[model samples]
Target: MKNILLIIIGTIMLLSCQRDDTEQIRIKTKELISTHFMGNGVQWSAYPHGDTENGEWGKLMTSEKWEMNFKRLDYMKPKLFRVLDQANWRYMVGFDSDGEPILDFHTPEVKAVEKILSYAQKNNITVLFGEWGTPYKMHDLDAGNSDKFKGANDPKWIRSIVAYLDYLIVKKGYTCIKYYNLVNEPNGDWASTKGDFEEWAEGVRMLTAALREKGLDKYISVAGPDAVTRYDNPNSTYSGAGWVRETAKQLDEMVGIYEVHDYTEYDLVRSGGFKKYHGDIAQLMAHTNKQIIFGELGFSRNGVENQERASRDLYACEDSQFDVFKFSYGVDMADAVIQSMNAGYSGAAAWALDDAMHTCGDLGNKNELKRWGMWNSLGTELCQNPADENMRPWFYSWSLLCRYFPSGCSVVKTDSTGIEGLRLTAGVYNDDITVAIVNNSGVDNTISLNIPTHKQLKKFLYFDGDRAVDVNRFPIPVEEKIDAKHSIELTMPASSFVILTSLDY
Candidate 1:
């Protein structure tokens, strides 16, 4: 998920006041929406080095009482989840050992997987085992035997793991768990660990082919989270040929998707941090022939008034050019899905379930780490519990885009607002057309809009501002009118995101 410069925005009124128009919905005063973004997921934090492994969470997961996390499975597993995209199951276990078997999947202590998997299936969330990560060498292997490229890095081990994953999808009656992440963070500091991008890409390529032979040809594959790179920086290691770019080239014939992590700004977004990692990846994937995913992302709420310094808050996305970067979850979801889909991405996930704290922890800010959860942060400065839970400000922003564009929707072009401070993107879902308008100004401003597709427009959601309103609760009031060709116009707000969805007439 790359965030390039802002798009162009001109004051050209979409419709003239003199135009005769008649539509079902009429224009009204500025409509406000608070809560919108809604979703939950389980990244591999509970696993060994990570958090959610075999039921246990955090330090508890790696300790003797690992099953403790599973005990709470029935109560929390499927509470309200859909995209159960297990990011590091295979990687956390590694390629040296026999994957799941080595991870003790057979152990009665780890039997909760059946319940978790069953719940995900019943709830309709597509189950995606994020591509596994390999180790730099045999020594890097976790004592648990999950790291790749170590002493036990036998090709036979690869075959077994692919076969095992295939068995889960086929024998288990699952059609949705069809994608595979080839490598996780295959770029960056691999050299020090005796691993490099070329080797990693080749290894992932072998695994991809192996999986195909194991009868898993339909599994879509992803590469990267090529750490942070500067599209503008020449010495920047990110722009250099990395695993994501290399692997996509080798697997050119395979039906697959190119992916990467978009946390380039880290936890500085709340301080108004900005970057073009999302757009740069989109451009990079262009040659590889694949869609993109931000992989993982989180905005800072630890700044002034919990909004932080502009230098730190990359969550609101100050980058003007792109509009598809969604936070955390890896399910290819969000408003940018429509736009990113047009760019090459089919969808994206929000990067996490209850691991908000983990994401914050990585930022190295203990205080901010607690505020990362979708529910509430541990700091109590942002979110605390269900009572104050209304989806973070970031969630609403995603709803402004994802609420309208589901799978199968084609992205449409916008009229182009050539302005640096504003960003506008449009997409079509079924017969409906949706426009996402964002004004990245610190202060509020007013602007006119032009929607050529529909005769009437209704505001779907607005992310940002002082409201915690959810998208489902309120529908933007549509003015009753239509232009000659049935075009509709409306007023938009400042530092706000207004989503206009088409109604089936």
Candidate 2:
């Protein structure tokens, strides 16, 4: 009788412990966010200054390097690609004595652009291509030129832009170039527009008229205002959100898409402040019937400190972020994407794909290269460190997002965890669902996902010491198959990102 009582008591204690463990899990239900999840991707640009004489892209374009990079891009399966360029870099050489706007479409620079467009064309990638700004007056190469290019309003500039688009779409057959952005970050005082809304609007008007005249309007439409938010000087007169509102009001007819740039602070994202802040912008643009995308997205943790550190430790550029080297950067970026999607952003393109794409101030000096990319393609040539070419940790999380967040899927928001630094965003397409959960806090949290799916899910995890990758550095599923019929419960490790998707890669 004593042995029987002891066995029963021990069994009861075990059952109680199991029940207690089950009760401790944090349960949250997924809610409908938006049925208009346009897409998600990264900014990929042509390398005009990448040569030994100019910068790092020449080496990256080699057969071997190109193959390696394209393979990785293929695996990522990016849906949207933002490609920005300058006039002088590709076709526009200079104006004639008569100022007829000299142009050449068969230059080596144009060929380099074709390489990018070819890939997008073949892979069916939606490309948002544009010039950096009013190309002539912005650069030192044209400082002494007699051309009086009136920013974007210049007739010559408008004609040149339209002609370039015509050549790409009508001649080269790259229908993949669906949208054209006139100026990048027109709201910033640093941009060519000098934050002049009237000037930018006039430019947009002129470009639209010219596109119609050249019959290129049918092929591509304008995307704006490509303005950056938050990082703008506090005392600045206009904010990025202000620019979007203005664009929607003033150029509603001409604009095909509404977009903005964000280089948010780490706290803003991890604390769930970004969603509320940008959510207002998304709400404001909802009535427009066009999609809003984050044209350029990056993390700017302690902006001044990161800038100072980038100058002191790595490259000597004033406009660079070194946090891309940290694993936590990936966690924060994943959080940003989740928040953006939940906030009604149809799509977002992460700041960049390769460090070799740009130099500080567009100076073309290899030493002043921007350090905000997944990897420096010129690591071997410019930095003399082959290891610099290796993929940074952030690529793991970002790739999963790009690969899994297919275009045209509905992005669903979940009920807030009420747990600081934890976020969830789900993509639902037909009967398939891909859910991403991010925990940017210091401690682990038990999460019971109340998603409506019973299909087998492939789980991919990103954490400091828990990530598993193949020899190619691509993510390997932690679990090849897990039943998701009932509520899915799992422990989200600290500073980690977890993706549970019903779709196979």
- Candidate number with greatest lDDT: 2
Question: What TM-score, computed on C-alpha atoms, does each candidate reach?
Answer: 0.62, 0.91
- Model 2 C-alpha lDDT per residue in residues 247-321, reported as the tens digit of each score: 888788999888889888777887889999998987766778788899899976347777778768555476777
lDDT (C-alpha, whole model) for all candidates? 0.40, 0.81
lDDT of 2 at 389: 90
Query: What does candidate 1's lDDT look like per residue over 303-355, in tens digits?
Result: 34334332354322222111122222211123233233334444455444332
Against the true structure, candidate 2 has what lDDT?
Answer: 0.81
Worst 10 residues of 2 by lDDT: 22-31
